[model samples]
Target: MTALRIALLGAESTGKSTLAQALHETLPVLTGLRVARVDEYLREWCDREGRTPRADEQRAIVEEQERRADALAVGHDVLIADTTGLMPALYSEYLFADTSLAAPAHHAHRRYHLSLLMATDLPWVADGMRDGPHAQAPVDRLLRRWLREGGHAFVVVQGQGPQRLEQALNAITPLLKDRAAALPPTSPSTVGKPASGGLFSRLLDRQARLPGSTRWTCELCDDPACEHALKSALPPATPRVP
Candidate 1:
């Protein structure tokens, strides 16, 4: 079976590392399934190289970040990525005004079963590779804009410490259930398609079928607000009697 991949995204000092570590330790006990965590490769790269990467080197960083996460997803029931390829792509855009990575990053991002966007509610702390607290809001805006343009849905994780961890767990628990019960089995023909159920099922149903296409494409659709509209129109589910 294909691993259920979860992506954690946010600006600097948003508790991504902390929350990822917590999930890595807690998920297996909660779900009784093998779990794997992919740490941000950029962090390790910075530590080893003693500096941040330049514009020319950004693609390599993003590639490695995604390569490691995809490798870990094999054989594991769940895979929590501390960060995704979108980070370096965003950094390249924010720091160097490079927009070339957007398409490839979005392609990589769609592989995730779910994306949890860490809120910028917590205070920022300086680290060796961190740019500054001042860069957080702009980076956050850029990240959201990119996700929207790419038509990807994400949950915003709020609070601090245990409260933050609790919020993340709450968002993921339902996904774990849906993934097990509703997702289509992975195969050579169906590989790279987003998992189906609920919102995803609606989205896929609306997409125009393309010949020999392995992934969903928006070639026939022009409405950017379609996702939001569909989400709002979905009726709340009624509880089942015991």
Candidate 2:
């Protein structure tokens, strides 16, 4: 099975991360496919350091997000990314007045099957790193424009808590059902940035695995990876090696 890479996107104070977590937890149960999650690295990096990122650091932040998501995609049947490379790109454009990050960010987005934009409807919460509610609307508008102008089809997520989660699930179900047809063919238009024979490529293989074909296993459970699980509908993997 080809892993469906789903990115939760939006401005700060939105429920992007929360929805990512909720979807990560619930998606596997519904899809019967193992899910791997790429968490937002910016927040973790910010909390570790003492401040928010400057213009130059934006590139690194975006790269790290792609790195995390790519690594998770190696083994899981579905990749749930809290945010995409778009965040850093937006930050550079908004705060630092730089658009250089956009190209790399768009390329990073091409790897995913879908990006869901989280709505800024919920009450804003201060996590120490957030730039406050003032930045929300503008940032949301900017992100929407970025996604639209980039020729990317993105779904907008609304509501609160469980309702929001249900909305995301509803959006994803059809994608999963038609994932094989939805996935891009192995060509330049759909090729991921990772190199051939790299750790990531060696594990996941590509979309449309035939019966008796080898499939990637849970990397954490075994060594040297790429263990086949015969032919199951989903990428054949368990939480642990059997």
lDDT of 2 at 12: 88
Tens digits of per-residue lDDT for model 2 on 1-242? 55689888888888988888888886655544567888889888898897998888889998988888887887567899889888888889999999999998998787777777776768989987889999987887787777767777565556658656755665565566565235445633225433434322321332223245222233421211122232122233111212
**On residues 97-143, what C-alpha lDDT tens digit does candidate 1 reach at each position?**
99898789999988887777776768889986898988887888787
RMSD of each: 11.4, 15.2
Candidate 1 global TM-score? 0.75
Tell me the spans in candidate 2 whose CA falls farther than 4 Å from its real position: 180-242
**Worst 10-residue lDDT window, candidate 2:** 221-230
lDDT of each: 0.72, 0.68
